[model samples]
Target: MATDSPHPTRKALRRNVLALLAVLAALLATLVSVSSASAAPTPTIVLVHGAFADSTGWDGVATRLSSKGYPVQRFDNPLRGPAHDSALLEKKLAAIDGPIVLVGHSYGGMVITNVDDPDVVANVYIAAFAPAQGEFVQGLLNPIVYPGSRLLPPALQVKVVDDPTGVAGRNLDGYIARPYFREVFAQDVSVATAADMFAHQKSAALVANLEPSGPASWTRVPSWYLVSGQDRVIPPALQRFMASRVAPGHTSEVGASHVSMVSHPAAVTAVIEKAATA
Candidate 1:
């Protein structure tokens, strides 16, 4: 201003260059962030436990999946009837931020079969039920129809309990008799571990097995099945029948008991990861 100094003009040019550089840096950062986010966003894995078991049964599988960078959640299945249990699961699925790889074990399969969430990218059944609309889990337990099932009579126990929710009026809870727990549920696992599982077992409402399934998501969603060759609770033959209904070429067999996730966690985890990547 005193005499139109070139030095002042030079200082103004430097400031403009610095500001422009800052703007470009910000844009570059945003683009890189977007690209990185789109390139490798891992899907969340939700593991649902079946009757006579709780979420802890998924500990081994969940840990393996988590180590591979997939987020894992072991859903605490209500053990209530399918309609009520599915409603609760659907609500939880809605809150998740990204795609989900849903894995179900035993009766947990029936629960996932009823969920219609769009976020559920794939369904992986681990020696689990995959019922059709109007079909009930109890139907699959028929020894005449799906022979080799050992979850009946002397191997099982049913207790009449007062329903607090009044959904079942008088709830009938089904449990795998203590002595038969290992044989009927998890023969592949260690005897001590099976005993531990028996101690923490959660009974499923009898209505859960008898109640007819509503809309089945397996009809629409992509599915993968792991047939437990030695499964006593659901029977291998029944597993094959259900797996056949799924889109062909997505089924695998494991020589495991009904609690495959506990005894063969790696094999079960592999199926889940396959579904996730697909």
Candidate 2:
């Protein structure tokens, strides 16, 4: 039997090479898996505050979301008007890469509804005004249509401001009078916190509420609504009315005020995270 065989060293070397190749293959597979997982996109959570409040209202929510490994952005709404704010938001959204979970509070809802961006995968309303096309925020805030709204005189104070755009009567800034800020906008938060929020409140121009919303993105995109059960600014009834228009079972209710994200950050974060995953 003339069986030819490699030298012992060569055979050992060949065995070592095979083992090294197997190790390399396993390592390469693991690296690919890690790369794919790290590359998986997690939608950015964009928070926009509505009338009588600023981006600070989203501090709690943003912190909670960040803790859970979700990217959060609190938009500095100009509070000019839906037409202007939405346009600005559209531009802002355009700059962001990957899917987005757009969450709006108060007038911010109006602005988000008007924005038409493919990146916005979900529209989450936190006691925000989700107006339909041709419908204005003011119209939805009507005390008659949805009573219990306290965002009226005594509670709301309007001041005429110089319009850089030179449009007469379009530059009015509406603030929730200091006395009623807590009750009207954030009743669930502490008095001190509410006062701080009031002091830093960003008023929306009257025209912002009056300007009719354009094509509502909610109609096309998936929407998640969180109704502030104790909200007096938009009225809980009105919130439900708007929520009803969204996809069924996408509505959540928290027994908080207009600023649920402030009063119940965990709940708000959960809703937004759900939307992000969805």
Candidate 3:
């Protein structure tokens, strides 16, 4: 054997070099796989504000999402009729590159229900309406939806503003009366903050709530719902019914108001994130 041992050290060195090269190749492949998985984009979360509220109500939720590296959109729902609002949302959605988790509060829920968006992974309702096809929000708020509901009557809590343009049903806006704003919408929020929010209230068209909604997006998309146990704008009973209808197992509740995003943003944000990751 020793007689055949020419350049044995060199042969041994070559073998070791080949083994090291194979190890590097395997490590490189593993790195590439992990890189691909990590590169996949996460979804965007869009929050649609309801009537008597604006996109600013979602400030806390938006900040939380942004800090966690999620792309957040606080949409200003026009408070127009369902079809018109849905059309605008659909067009805006066309520009987004990734998936979306659409969240709606109060009347905004009706708006989201009207849109047919394939990109929406899930619809998250936050003490919001979930009207079926041909069901108007105004009708749902009446005794027919949740008969024993004690939410403030719209006629008393809202100030009716006539359309200055003389359009009969177009711009008849309704603003939440400042005096009842605390009890009706933001009871859970601090008095100072509630007052500030009331000062900047945005009016919604009275006709918009009266208009009928189209087919519900929940018919196709998966959904998560958060019921504010003490919600005054949208009754707790109505919220529970909607939640059960949309997503039975995915529903949660907090002892908050209709503006839960402000009073209990953590709970609202958690539900939204659950949908996004799902």
The global C-alpha lDDT for each of the candidates, from Candidate 1 onward, is: 0.88, 0.86, 0.84
Q: How well is each residue in 58-103 modelled by candidate 3, as lDDT tens digits?
A: 9999999999999988777878788988899998888888888899
* Per-candidate alpha-carbon RMSD to the true structure: 7.4, 4.8, 3.7
Candidate 1, residues 75-184, lDDT tens digits: the string is 88989888988899989998898898889998998999999888888999998889889999888777788788878888889988777744556777989898889978
Spell out the clash pairs found in candidate 2.
50-107
TM-score of 3: 0.84
- Per-residue lDDT of candidate 2, residues 211-263 (tens digit): 88888888899999999898777788989999999746899899998788888
Clashing residue pairs in candidate 1, if any? none
Where model 2 places Cα greater than 4 Å from the true spot, the runs are: 1-38, 166-170
Clashing pairs in 3: none
lDDT of 2: 0.86
Question: How do the predictions measure up, each by TM-score?
Answer: 0.85, 0.85, 0.84
